[model samples]
Target: MSKRKLRVGLIGGGGIAQAVHIPGWNNLPEAEIVGVADLSEATARKAAAIAGTKEVFTDFHELLKLDLDVVDVCTPNKAHTPAVLAALESGRHVICEKPLAVTTAEVRAMGELADAKELKLMTAQHQRFTQSGVAARAWVDAGKVGEVYHARVRAMRRAWLPPSPGFIDGKLSGGGPCMDIGVHALDLCMWLMDFPTPVRVSGTAKTVFAKGHDMPNLWGEWDRERYSVEDFASGFVHFDNGATMVLEAAWMCHQPDNEELMAQLFGKQGGLAWPEATFSTATNGIFAQGTLTPTTQVPHPHWNEIAAFADCVLNDKLSPVPWTETIKVIGILEAIYASSNTGAEVAVKG
Candidate 1:
């Protein structure tokens, strides 16, 4: 007798879906992508072919009707709340891409509904599954860096702005680099800090370069008229624990490196930087600094994230990236935008 395979359905057959997500699901022998749904029939068909499934639906509602144990949402930022809520209403576990939703209210609604329905809801923050991320988490958990006081996060690119309406358009994407790449580093930093409650936030968001032809984009040119979102954003956060953080993100910047994605934590006992896994501390009146190597290396963080989610579902365990933690992240981000708009420090409502 063979074990029954988990039936999976995917919503939104876009680039991320075809590139990493479809491959991640296919890598799991115990999981089967039973259907794929997209607004475009051609994209649905293409993703269905990649998933080794003939079932394709132009409407995601039709995909939800399938006997799916899990729903993978790869839709645009604006579509996440509805799709995730609908999937949960249909009695399916859901895993949504980063930023979960644009607003804290939407995230809370989905999270509360999932709790009421006793279904697992996870956010696909893949950076937490990376080799360096895992090592840094373990190191922090072991009390290497005690009493974290402040942190710095950055997700700056020289000129790699995504040339898509789903990203650059404010209506579709909600925010700019703050919502796109900034969420990646911000989430990682908050997770490392064990999800401190953000009490207040002061920020600035500006359309510095996307509107002009001064900076040539590395990813190709985008529509200047359609570019409504900010090209750069920065925020200062105050946590409930009296800890503070500085976050900076940009799609175009005059920086030396092509890109510099970092999250550095400063603590009373030590300081640590992620991706690099470098740490500094004074032991026995001697200064010590070294790079921490992960005991295990994850070649594909997305695949590992999928596997982790699957493991939790199979064993009836909690979501690997629960919504409770996600809400805090979204709250801070929402406040950043609000602060930017009002030109005043706004209270983070979590």
Candidate 2:
């Protein structure tokens, strides 16, 4: 740990902030959470109490006025862009929660602002810090999964639909499982493939069981009338490098697993699967296979993610998860939603 302590201002004192972001920052010896801001004053105060800070504000702009080195944004999907922009403008580096923005355009604007300020802006895609993800990335970087041409990504839940308005409501969430859990697997898979430019997307997003009482939710009951987002989504993507990907995301389904978050890639020379973190290949006409075990185990990936972001900001290192890479992921997802609505393949511009 460095001797200098980073002053961090946290925005959005919600579940993610309480569950991971705040705790992760607290685990860092070189970081001190100085302020917390949320839409609800009580939520802000509660988060501040946990973070060992008295500075709490309902308006994030007020929190920005404080002396801070970085802003950790755990706001909803739609709020990410504005919060990140404000943080950058306040002369602070930023680490924002996943689905950095609902659209590629918003992501582009935020990325541009960060670039102009020469600030470290990282998306909190903590899954990349997991043991399996680390090993998988290392294997891909070693050319073990040579020339990935296709992938299968899944983020499905049997019946665990989130019982929160922020997740079920389209206005707040921007999208359902596709933007929530699906983004996790999709981003990792795309990163593994080195983010090939997406050319087109064909997809479907439907409210199969969320708006009715057919399936019982594992996470308690939610307001069906407020459920404006999709309960299930599937998409196919074509990339510029002649690569392709299939993605599935669902909050409720007839699945054996409570949840299955996975990404499997197929390359010309080999194939690989995540969470499993295993690879298969053939050499000299002899088949070979192996599973990669990570050198280190990160009990809390969010902590490692926060530490990485702070290190980048404090040491002038490149952002571990740059917005440039994130835009491509979001672009594919946005195209998927558009295609679903239009009943035709949608072109991906970003």
Candidate 3:
């Protein structure tokens, strides 16, 4: 008596695909993963097992031949553009992992293609689905944080460098922590600020501790020879609306905290910070501070993200995290690297 479930095909069966994405799809009763494709047959089989489907393929293009309503791309950062383009051209809605594309141009092309095809395309910015993020957004939207003019964003880890060629290699990962965890806090802050247009950026990306043995990694030893990306990056952004932001990302630092992912916003009326959901302001001419509490916890933010994407696709709703927003995020990141290379403030083209 029920209509058919939305058929899905997965494009890369790596750790993210197997651990969160596939499981997220399995949680949606209105969706069913029909097939999985990975370069490794073993990885494909492992993901297909989780999807409860034996259909597996080594090439994603082969899986695209099937009747699929959606394609979930869990590939490495550099591979996201190609996979997303192929999926959109195949007449399938797409949900891709974050830092959707390394370059703003690549994101624009993919976004334009999806627009022409009239397909739903969402970037997997799972942090937005977190309780803290959701709560902060609500407060900001309610004018609690009025006219935010500046923000401090950080995604620093003491010694949690990812141990993989896909992340360490510049050709694969595009950059370093700036693309990895930095995108998380940056995206959240920008979203809360209603996505200001970044006009210019000055940044520095360096291999301070990654290429040396001074700092030991908590995630175990990685190939220092293959590590071609920056271990630390800092940037300053000026927006069209006169708003400013300070961004910092690092895989390894001399900090005591294991991690310190934060986004602190300063506004005309008040100030707020995330990953803590705390706020400060002057009410009735007196100083006041409070913590924004989550009405409910998101047990699995990735699952909530998947559900939202599927809902938008099935119901003709707007993409919860559209490529338009993602392009802006990528533009800022791209400008950071460009500024670092040229030793000058780089203009971000909208």
Candidate 4:
């Protein structure tokens, strides 16, 4: 007798779902995507076809009717909360895309529901599944970078502003570069630091170049009138452990690199940088600097992330990227926007 395959349902059958997530679910022999839901019927049909399933729905609620073991949410930032809450309520484990809910309140709502239901809820932060990221994390776990005190994170793009309404519209996407790209680097940084409690944040968010025609977008033009979110944001964070961090994110900036995504951690014993996987330390009055090599290669981080989520559900293990850690990430980001609005330091809870 063969083991029954884990049936999965997909919410938001858009680019991320079709491009990486659908293929990711397909790659796992123990799991299969049974249905796909999208706002557009055509998109839902397209994603369903790719998943080799006939189940397609224009409404996610209809997809939720299926006897699915898991729900993968690839929706835009704003839609995450409702979809995740619904999936949790339906007694299904869930994996949602980054910036999980844009705010801590929404994160708590979904998180608490999942906890009550005893279902796994994971955030799809694929950067942490990369080869370099794995190597850096192992090193940090081994106390290579002991007692981290300060960190620097950046997610800057020269001129790659996504022209999509879901990205530019604050009502849909919640925030701009801070929430879109900044969340990636910030999450990785905090994860490496063992998720220190964020106490306060002071930041600035502005729409510097998206509305203007001076800086041409590399990904093409976006609607100037609908561009309500900030193109650039920066923040200073203070943690409960007396640690501090400086973060910067931008969609358009005058930089040498087309895009520079980085997270560097400074500690008392050593300093480490991610993606680059470089580390520096001094012992016995001698300087040592070297790159950490991963024992295994992760060419497809998205697939690994999908596999990790599925494995947790199948084996009854803890979620790889739990909501507790995610709330801290969102809390800092929410504080950044709050501080930006009031021009004052915002206190972060939890």
Q: Each candidate's root-mean-square deviation in Å?
A: 0.7, 1.4, 0.8, 0.7
In terms of lDDT, which candidate is stronger, 2 or 3?
3
> Which candidate number maximizes lDDT?
4
Q: List the residue pairs that clash in candidate 4.
A: none
Question: Residues 45-102, candidate 4, lDDT per residue (tens digit)?
Answer: 9999999999999999999999999999998899999899999999999999998999
Relative to the true structure, candidate 1 has a C-alpha RMSD (angstroms) of: 0.7
Backbone-clash count (model 1): 0
Instruction: Report lDDT per candidate.
Output: 0.94, 0.92, 0.94, 0.95
Poorly placed runs, candidate 2 (over 4 Å):
1-4
TM-score of each model, paired residue for residue: 0.99, 0.98, 0.99, 0.99
TM-score for candidate 3, residues paired by index: 0.99
Instruction: Tell me which of candidates 3 and 4 scores higher on lDDT.
Output: 4
Candidates sorted by lDDT, descending order?
A: 4, 3, 1, 2
lDDT of 1 at 335: 91
96-189 per-residue lDDT for model 2 (tens digits): 9999998999999999999999988899998899989998988988888899889999999999998888888899889999999999999999
**Candidate 1 lDDT tens digits, 87-181:** 99999999999889989899999999999999989999999999999999999998999989999999999999999999999998999999999
lDDT of 1 at 169: 91
Off by over 4 Å in 1: none
